[model samples]
Target chain A: MSTKPASERATPWALVTPALLWTLCFFVLPFAAMALTSVTAKDGSFTLSNYAQFFENPSYWRAMVNSLQVTAIVTVVSVLLAYPLAWILAEQVPERFQRLALMLAVLPFWTSYVVRSYSWLLVLAQNGVVNRVLTGSGLFADPVQLANTRLATVIGFVHFFVMLLTLTIFANLKQLSPSYRKAAADLGAGPVRTFIHVILPLTLPGIVVGAFLTFVLAIGDYITPQILGGNNELLMPQLIMMQIGRRGDFPLASALAIILMAVVTVAYLASARWLKIERA
Target chain B: MRAFAKILATVYALLLYGFIFLPVVVLVLFSLQATQFPIPPFTGPSTRWYAAVLADTRLTTGLLHSILVAVGSSLVAVTLGFLSAWGFARFYLPGSAFLRGLITLPLTVSYLIIGMGLLVLFNRVGIPKSLAAAGIGHVVVNLPLCFAIIYSQMGDHQINIERAARDLGASEWKVLLLVTVPVMAPAIFASFFLSMTFSWDEFVISFLLTRFETTLPVEIWNLLRSGLNPKTNAVGSLVFGVSIVLVVAFELLLFRRKQS
Candidate 1:
């Protein structure tokens, strides 16, 4: 392949150039522009005021705190909820039905993301079905406030991420040969012990990957918080959106976005230590 | 005891399924509501909201814009991704691994951050917010996915075929267009389909990058902010319906062929 003619030597470069250039111009350059803008003040002077503002403002820093809390909650809850479901699909369901079950599990993911949150809003509204059910079934005295709260945001995030984590964990569970389980049983380990020691340890990488993905996506998201969360409390994305949408403050927004990116990078590094983070 | 555990597992699975599908069920059921509110009371099933959604020019235009952006961006993303994937697979280049990683670096970043970066860059560069700008952002997000998918599928088998074609005196362009592409059609098509779906449903980038003539998700967001109406549910159900059809069709047409 390296012994190509002079005219053909540049073919690979030509083939790859468009994508490289596109990524450079649209992705890399824009990111560079954003980083530069984050450090520049309104008057075009170099300043750390935008970054400093996040530290000085309790409300702004509170958004970051809120984001981390919500993301951590969503990641942990989704992984817990999804593991059993993934196990059921992988181990209990007949092999022929596994694909269909997995597809059904993730079916709602195809819904427009905005609409997914809105649907949750409708379901959790004062006059919504959940309220009607609780009231009708005598589960509660009245329709509890479910929508337009941090609870609603967490629920929305968890709902989406459960489907996602289930897929990853399911794939992980499927890849495990029956030999491991058989070997555990042959060694006099009970079902619970086998699962606890062998299965759980084997799937930790998949769990970590899915949990990290849930953390990154749930933290940076704006729609679920905006639609389902109402204006009760702000998250990092909501705070960044506020800077741009309300005040047209790009510097401040960039600073917040960089901070968010930094957090995600830290998460990726943490997770990568446990998992190889390889690409085929 | 085993039977009781089995029954419990079945019940758990059913409950989980119910929780997962609850919002979608509510959304679709309310989309057919005869009245104003999309909330409960089990109103008469009617297509009136769907009719209203179709009637609204803003939504209809937004739908077309979404289709255009999704198709156009996905096509470009797939093309560039395929070419680059072939280049790196077929030919050795200096620092290729680093270059490939650089191309895929966007995959780790959040879409909100990507959108924000573009918004600031476009603002400074005086590029007015439009569908094109949004499409560019969509390409940025989808290109890495396309690259990874297509690159992974470019195994030794395809290279062997390409070598055979070249040995048979076929020109480079001829081999790529006739031999390499057909062999990689399934991968290319899969990447294109995935890219289209991502671009179609992408919200944050389109939200930040477009103005008056925005995409459907942005339009839907406006409808949501304006008020809760059955129209939003109707449109949502419509999108869901269309996406399901596409997924089923792809599964049948592509996966079935591959399996056989």
Candidate 2:
């Protein structure tokens, strides 16, 4: 593309100014402010006590540990459930019906995400359908406590993330040339071997990208843990919110949020090689 | 063997679909419950709870607030995003790649962090929380999405036509307004529509940034905190219904146009 020589230079910069300024003021400036807030004491003096609190308090540090554990579990379980489903849709289902199948598979995602978590609470409650099924079948004498637990939180996260992983993985699968699969089979590979040695390796980028996204979103979410986890334990986001909501501790919340962001940044770096926004 | 495999695939698909729909099924089914409890022994199908939800003044205000914020923020996001995308696509400015990356950077950050950052910033700046504050947060969240979608659709084919229009003595604004806008309408509309949906359904930012008057999700969350009632179910069902209608309409109208 050729740029016009003189006046057009200013025009392009003028056109871009609003968005650049908006992002700078709202996004970048806030981030800088948060970082500054994180270091400042409540008395308006510089201190490292906020960071110290996270390390010294077991309860606070436990939230970070719990966040990582739950995020890992959700990412792994969602990818496991989603990949085969994506495979089925791409290779097993006929090409024409795939779109409809995929849409139906993910249709429930259109519901409000907060509402979705709340709905899961109902479904997993003592008198809910799962318990009723278990007791009705004489498998147990009483309902197992399902709602307001880590298990419930995981279920909610996985349910939503499975849809996302399936979408990414399915797109990746569709992009593979048929000749690759044919060659794998012709090279004396069975279906399992072909998938393991050929297809899975090729689709690893999609899996990594989706899994990393799941990690970032799941860790940062306040709703799923708050509504489902029942405060039995806190996650990083909940702890961060509690600081601001109840205590009016903006400094602590800023510190906690920066910590949470740091975790996401580390995850991004680990998966950065495979991550790209452009559809391949 | 092939028949067995087909049967297994069908069963797997059915099971997954069942898992996906179970919560929503329980949600809608319990919304019609005549009794207080949302579980055990399906009761008389009643619209009483739905009536209660509609009558709630706070919730109705929240619904309106949600619409206002979603529309207002999405308009800002899409407009700013479109202008920047056009500028970047049209020009070879210094560090253009780095600048574009800076604009797109927030897509990686979580809304909780974004909200927390803004909450801290607003406190430092002495800005009070309001619907406008929440709307500003929404713009921060949605702007990157709008930029990426609009940016991706700005192909050289459209640029050539835009140049032709400019050569015919159209001013920059005129060419942009008359030609580029029409050409990129699909992407623009899609991004706008998508940003609206995200903003409408968004929870955390509005929850953190707003005071008494807030968006629907935050209000519904408050209702949930008060107690587990069928009214919450009714509200969720209502949101689900409206969202489904909009999505289906978008599919039929906008996406179909793109396909053809």
Candidate 3:
């Protein structure tokens, strides 16, 4: 490409200015404002009281812990279910079937996330499909209380997200050469050993990327837990919503948002490191 | 051994497909169930919920608002994305790598943060959070995706062709209008459709920003919070039906093009 003259240089800037300004005004400035609001006291004094409250209060701590616990469980389950499915799609499928399989993998992602979560609500409610099946099969005498439980929330998260994880991992798998697997097989390594030594290490970057995405999304989700989680399983996003909507405590919500941002940033940094190492 | 592996793969594929479609199947089936409960012992099929959903003027208006926003945002996003991608592809700009990274960084940020951040910014700037503000926020969130798609498609071959056309005395604008743009049509179309889908389905930002004219997902959220109703399923089924048709049509068209 040739360099443009100084007069022409303004063209790219002109083209990019709207998007740049949008991001600056909408994305960068608001977070800064939110951070500022977090430290500002109700009486107009700068104070660390909001952070202190968040840390000192057992309910806040419990909410954070529960959010982390649910995120971890969902991440693991999504990966576990997605990996085998990705492997089968990548290694075992015929070329002609690949596109269909990949399309199937991405279809769930195209649906509205809230609608998908609501579908789970309908499926896991006390008289929902799972209980109906269980009772009708004579496995239970009555419908199971599945909705509003921790189990229901986790199940919803996995159901909604596992397809995305599979697609990411499958993309990574497709980029790997088949010869490595063939060489391991020729050396008499079984499928399990081959996967453990060869495929697993090679695909770690995708795993890291997928897991990070799933965890961040799962933790940031307010709607899923708000709809699916009963009283006992309140998560951080829901807590932030409550502060903002119910209690009208913008400072507390802003403080909690900052904390959530920090946690996400830390997790992301760690995952980036693992991804870089895997790539190396 | 190969046959057995093929069988296993087929079974896995079936299961994966089942996973994707299960909820949709359940929603469609239960939308017609006479029993208010989601339990599978269906008394009979019923269209009462669909009638109820059609009767709700708020939801219908919300759907219309959603369509308008999606179209407006996608157009803005794609136009911006095309310009930025062209700059990156055709110019030797400084800090291009950093610019690329910055463009894509929004994908990592949660919608919750984006929604809150936009709300605060709009509030400070006296933008009066409305449908336009929501559209602007969506464009920001979607621009990176559009840029990525367009940038990837503006490959070396396409760039070289455009350069050749320019060297033959064609103006920069003419080259873009005649040669480069046509070559990148499929990518532009795909990105447009994707942006439309994203903006249409977006919840958090619209929910946060819209005071009067809420988008479909926001309306759906409000309805869900009020109470669960079969009417919600009717609306969902309509959305799902439209999306499935569009996606399937696009898939078939793309497949045929690839084959040809």
Better of 1 and 2 by DockQ: 1
lDDT of 3 by residue, A70-169 (tens): 9999999989988988888887778888878788777766668788888888888777777878888899998888889898899889987788888899
Model 2 over residues A6-52: C-alpha lDDT tens digits?
A: 77668999988999998899999999999999899867899888988
Q: Give the per-residue lDDT digits (tens) of candidate 3, residues B201-233.
A: 999889888999889999888888755567777
| lDDT-superior candidate, 1 or 3 | 1
Put the candidates in lDDT order, highest first: 1, 2, 3
Which candidate leads the pack in lDDT?
1
lDDT of each: 0.93, 0.91, 0.84
State which candidate, 1 or 2, has the greater lDDT: 1
Candidate 1 residue pairs that clash: none
Per-candidate TM-scores read: 0.98, 0.97, 0.93
Instruction: Look at candidate 2 and give me any clashing residue pairs.
Output: none
Q: Which 10-residue window in model 2 chain A sums to the lowest lDDT?
A: A271-280
- CAPRI quality band, candidate 1: high
**Fnat per predicted structure, each in turn:** 0.86, 0.83, 0.53
Instruction: Give lDDT tens digits, candidate 1, residues B71-112.
Output: 999999999999999999988899999999998989999999
